[model samples]
Structures are given as C-alpha cells and as structure tokens.
Target: METAYIETPLGIASISGDEDGITSVSVTKESSEKPSTKIPVILQDGALQLQEYFQGNRTDFDLKLNPAGTDFQKKVWDELLNIPFGKTTTYLDMAKRLGDPKCIRAAASANGKNPLWIIVPCHRVIGSDGSLTGYAGGLWRKKWLLDHENPVKQQSLF
Candidate 1:
C-alpha cells in the first residue's frame, strides 16, 4: 500500500491505500514520515477530503473506503457511517441497531477498532449519559472534532 502523511490541526495524519481505494487514515501525536511531495493517485482525493473536513468545509466524506476488519466489525463501522455530522450516538444504540442490544460491548469494541478514523466517525459515539466516551485518537482529539463539526454559535443579545 502507498502511504502519505499530511499535517492536520490534530497532528500528523497518515493516509494509506492503493487503486483498491483508501484503506486507512489515522492521526498521531507525531509521525516520522514527512508529508508526501506527490500523494499517490489513490489517496489524493481522500487526503483532500480530510483536509476539507478539518477546515470545516466538508461535513461528510465521499471517497472510496476499504477498511480491513471482520464481518461484525465491518457491520459496526457501517453503522457508524450513518451517524450524521454534528450528531452523536451511544454504544447501546449502536448495538440495538445491529439487532442485539446485548452486543453493546461488542459494538463498543468494533467502534474502538475503527481504522478509518474521522472518515468512519467512530468519534461520534458517546456514552449513554451523553458524556464523551472512548476514542482511539484520545478524548481531546475527539472533543476537538466534535466541537469543530458543531461549534456553538454566538447568540444575538438584541
């Protein structure tokens, strides 16, 4: 797979894929790899979408994704995609949607293992009490993304 790194407000983002479509997009505190002088053709659009996302110019991703995971995990990740921008859902809700509320833990596990990061939007999952819960990229980044997607608008004091 061809890999490319790009600087993001969150940090360095590593995007990887080939002609089969984007396989992964992950963020890190730092990366040894430098931003690509020539991003691979397969990854160019995905990278641009991510940049637009961070700039608040894009709400939903529209790139081909090919995240590797088990069938159950794929199901969970697919459900995550249904979550709208600026909206959040709980693990229990995800489990119920998957046709078994008892699978909340499994759903949470799949959510935690989401490989596409912001593209899949596992960060949109929250605790039942509406508290920010687990996020693979760390809670701070999750909070930043949530805030960036749905910033509080200042009210007029007329």
Candidate 2:
C-alpha cells in the first residue's frame, strides 16, 4: 500500500491505500515517517477529501474505502457511516441497530477498531449520557472533530 503524510489541524495524518481504495487514515502527534514526496494517484482523492473535511468544506466523504476487518466489525463500521455529520449516537443505539442490544460491547469494540478515522465517523459515537468516550484517536481529538463538525454559532444580539 502506498502511504502519504500530510499536515492537518489535528496533526500529521497518514493516508494509505492503493488502486483497491483507501485502506487506512490515521493521525499522530508526530511521526518519524517522512511526508510523501508525491501522493500516489490512487490515494490523492482520499488525501484531498480528508483535507477538505478538516477545512470544513466537506461534510461527508465520497471516496472508495476498503477497510480490512471481520464481518461483524465491517457491519459495525458500516453502521457508523450512517451517522450524519454534526450528529452523534450511543453504543447502545448502535447495538440495537445491529439487531442486538446485548452486543453493545461488541459494537463498541468494533467501533474502536475502525481503521479509517474521520472517514468512518466512529468519533461520532458517544456515551449514553452524551459524554465523549472510547475514541482511538484520543478523546481530545474526538472533541475537536465533534466541535469542528458542529461548531456553536454565535447568536446575534439585536
């Protein structure tokens, strides 16, 4: 898989994929890995889309994704994609949608294991009490993303 690193408001984002499609998109505080001299053609769309997302110009991703995971995990990840921009859902809700409320933990596990970061929108999942929780990218980053997608608009004081 070809990999490319780009600077984002969050940090250095590593995007990896091939002709098959984008396989992974991850962020790190820092990385010894050098930025791609040239982003591979197959990965350029995903890279551009991610940049657009961070810029707040794109609400939803429209690139081909080919994440690797078990069937159950894939089901969970697919459900995550249904979460709209600026919206959040609880793990229990996700479990119910998956046809078994008892699978909340399993669903949560799959959410944590999601490989495609912002693209899959796993950060959109929150605790039952609406608290931020269990973001593989870090809770701080999750908060940043949720705020980015749903920033509080200043009201006019007439």
Candidate 3:
C-alpha cells in the first residue's frame, strides 16, 4: 500500500492505494510528515479528482476503488456509489434498497466506515428528517459538501 496527504477544504486528507486501485481516503486536521508507505499513482489520481470535485467543475469520479472491508460493508459502499452527485438519500432508504429495512443502523455504520470519502459519495446520506447526521469527516464538512453539490436557489423572503 502507498499513501499521500493532500490539503482539502474540509481538512488534510490522507489517501492510500496500490496497483489494484485506491483503497482508502481519510480526513484529519494534521498531515503526517512520515506516511507509513509510498505514494501511489492511484492515490494521486483520486486526489486530483477530489480537487476537481471541490472546485465544482467535476461531478463524477472515474478512478477505480478497492476499499478494504467486510462483505456487508462492501455491499453498502457499492450502493453508496449509486447515489448521484448533488443528490441525497436517507439511511432507511439505503437500508430498504439493500433489502433490509431493519438495517438502518448497520447501513449508517457502513457509511461511516466508507474509506473512499467523496468518491464513494457517502456524504449524500442524511437523517430521515433531512438533517445532516453522522459523517466520518464531520457533520460540518458534510453540510458544506451537500450545499456545494446542491446549492439552494437564492430568493427574497418577503
């Protein structure tokens, strides 16, 4: 595995991957000078795509992903990829789509564990009431991302 750190609007992001594809992306307040492995081309590609996404010039990512997780987590992550850019879904919605209406908590947990971040589109998941909920990168960042994706139409409130 290889790793690299990049600065993002949310925070410093650590990306890791290998020839198989990008494996993980995590956000943190600080950057590590000594990463545990080398920086791979797959991670670099993901970082570049993320930069384009934050600039609002890109909506979809094209890099390959190989996040490490259990079978359920993999299934949840795959479902997350189906969430269109600038759109949102609820935990219950995802759970039901996955054929387990009672697995909302498990769905949320899998969402929280998503390692590919924006590329995986896990931030598109929201509370049942349409409020921002748990986000591994922090709820504030999640709100910012959603707002960035689906900007509200400004109107005069008389």
The residue-by-residue lDDT of candidate 1 on 8-77, one tens digit each, is 9888899999888888889865667577788888888998999999888999999888899999999999
TM-score of 3: 0.88
lDDT of each: 0.90, 0.91, 0.86
Residue 17, model 3: Cα distance from true site in angstroms: 0.3
Better of 2 and 3 by lDDT: 2
Candidates 1 and 3 compared by TM-score, better number? 1
Q: Superposing every Cα of model 3 onto the true structure, what RMSD results?
A: 3.2
Encode model 2's per-residue lDDT on 82-143: one tens digit a residue. 99999999999999999999999999999999999999999999999999988888899999
Please estimate how well model 2 matches the true structure, expressed as its whole-model Cα lDDT.
0.91
> In model 3, which regions exceed 4 Å deviation?
31-39, 151-158
Q: Give the per-residue lDDT of model 3 (tens digit) for 33-100.
A: 44434446657778788889888889999998889999999999999999998899999999999999
Error of 1 at 120 (Å): 0.3
Best by lDDT: 2
Q: What shift in Å separates residue 27 of candidate 2 from its native position after superposition?
A: 0.7
